[model samples]
Target: MSPEFYTISQVADILSVSKETLRRWDNNGTLIPERDDGNNYRLYHKSQLEQFEQAQLLFQSNWNDELNIKASRPYKMLELFAGAGGLALGMEKAGLESVLLNELDKHACNTLRENRPDWNVVEGDISNIDFSEYHNEIDVLTGGFPCQAFSYAGKKLGFEDTRGTLFFEFARAVKETNPKVFLAENVRGLLNHEDGRTLETICDVIDDLGYKLVNPRVLKAIFYQVPQKRERLFLVGIRKDLISNSEFDWPSPYHRIMTMKDALKAGELYDCDVPNSEGQKYPKRKAEILAKVPQGGYWRDLPDDLQREYMMKSYFLGGGKTGMARRLSWDEPSLTLTCSPAQKQTERCHPEETRPLTVREYARIQTFPDNWKFSGPISAQYKQIGNAVPVNLAFAVGRSIIKTLNIIEKNTAMNKKKCA
Candidate 1:
């Protein structure tokens, strides 16, 4: 059986507050519960808490204990454009504390706040927020800022050239915070975006801001324990000053790649098969057409007349159009999940059923914990899950950050000793 009672320290740790604060709240009747053996020891009975609405919610939804995963030291981070807290939660699991997180989406913000009450979530446009408050305090800064092209004013695009784009805010935050390191993650398309000039300009801006950009690499998530064929371009930077004695290493790939079966079934990923949950339904005729496609097959597998019927005007268009009517295979990693599973251009059909993937399946592919509830309508939840960085990928990156921070701390301590 689960423990019948919790210690003062346990409750404080779960709520991410202090024992003194809990005692004060208990004394004031703000969170009053029964007393222990003596009146001096204030104890909360688990049964009585069921009646208190707020306490009940706290009892059910807390994740603070999971936050205390192994780490050499607590490193602080300031994240920009944090979506659904995927990267933040992953980093937290890897022992980095999210001192502040900024996200513009209200629904995503609600998801973060509902899960972590103490987190300082700034829910608004990044342009309006100032990073000066975090200056010199944050050990690292990170953002998956959207890619946009800036009109080049000269041979080198200065900070002014990127003023209107979201990347400028990311650069501005890095410049202002002057952290020991920062990481920028983007879609793989960025490497070739704008005939590659856009990425070149971004690198120039980062270099101009006085950071050493590592040879940016596209890390495939399938190599990192994420059960989806997702690829992201990771641009890691270290403040020029910190690069002398330390080398930053990206997380090593897991020994084995996880397949779609590993994601949705009850095996390595979870103890039980996915819980039945709501999922998108294909149109009746579309479902019938897709049902004919074998596992791992797409629209091309359909009969010629059905393909012509489904393809419509697009049948005459050039290129493969491979995403149409695709069915995932149990043994293969899923093709990158799209925002709308039912979209014709990018269908991720269920391997067995002709329906789109269920919400739980989507979360599993993204490596979100089963109990980590999202907040919103079904569509909103799908969008949030689809847009997020896979939590395991984030955790892998977080471990690298901790490793780098450890090196920085050691070097700093050595310098101090020499001065002393």
Candidate 2:
């Protein structure tokens, strides 16, 4: 049977707050826990937690209320920088058909083609491709283009001024396809990249291309059912003509946060425990040192001598450097994954095991289904999965996009009837 009460740490993880915050809340009488037999340990009854906003999501009854939006008719999407099909898979689950997917990486292209043989997987440089043939043929054009700084000659940047960057190519596709809507996903850093001028220029370029840019929002992946604390900034643009009629809404957050357990174990997110697969191993000395670090701890948790030895001169340096020698806790979300999980500065060690997260485990954290086969060498596979937009997060956003398209479709049909 499920436990009747939760410890302070358990409640903190469930609410995604630090223990200190819980202590403050306890002092404030916002959420007071009962003392155990010895009057030492604080225990929270499960029923009391139900009153908080975050805890409400954990209830099955609450999940049922979230909108189950669907595509009214077949909608087509063209994806760029489509790595290992994470976003594509989510969009597919959300009922959007992929007409064409472009990726410069050979391995990623092969992975896409291998999984969905019917998808038009375009391989090689995006700059060489001409998208005019797809003009007005697609419903959405989406990409997670790499953020690059534009060479501003101190002039007001416009559509043509962003020519040298990959974003320009993305914008070019938007212009050529003339999709009813388009989405661009990038790292949260893009919001303040080059002191926010890059994003400002992107907005201006979107306007020049005859698209109305929505106020971009940074979406926290953990809030969207992904068991990783990844943040992605999304910019949605609607074609200028459709802007007046379109009503676009961001996807709602999932009721409760998913934990590492949800990703790897047989739970709501998956039907089976994660299958064993290849993963990187730590060196003997490193493994010995890490064994001493507790789950949910980093290098700082090591003994003073070991800390100095393991961290070297960097130990004297400042900042938390929390990812180093870090081990995940089963109850909390995993850290944002990187291209290499075993790297010293950003280790993603398994919660109970000494080694790094396995290839399949890595994929699981990113919300890729068990059957989504990744191509190329193991390292390439890791890179592809690491670089992907979390599949579930993408699905949530895709559902919102579909809902907006449905409204647009209904309005268009109504206008046609009026003309008749």
Best by TM-score: 2
C-alpha lDDT of residue 126 in model 1? 94
What lDDT does model 2 reach? 0.89
What is the C-alpha local distance difference test score of each model? 0.83, 0.89
lDDT of 2 by residue, 238-265 (tens): 9888876788888777766788999999
What stretches of model 2 exceed 4 Å from their correct place? 1-67
Q: Can you give the TM-score per candidate against the true fold?
A: 0.82, 0.91
Candidate 2: Cα lDDT at 110: 92
Q: 269-345, model 1: which lDDT tens digit per residue? A: 77888888898898789888999999978988989999999999888899788888899888667889888788999
Q: Per-prediction RMSD in angstroms?
A: 18.7, 2.8
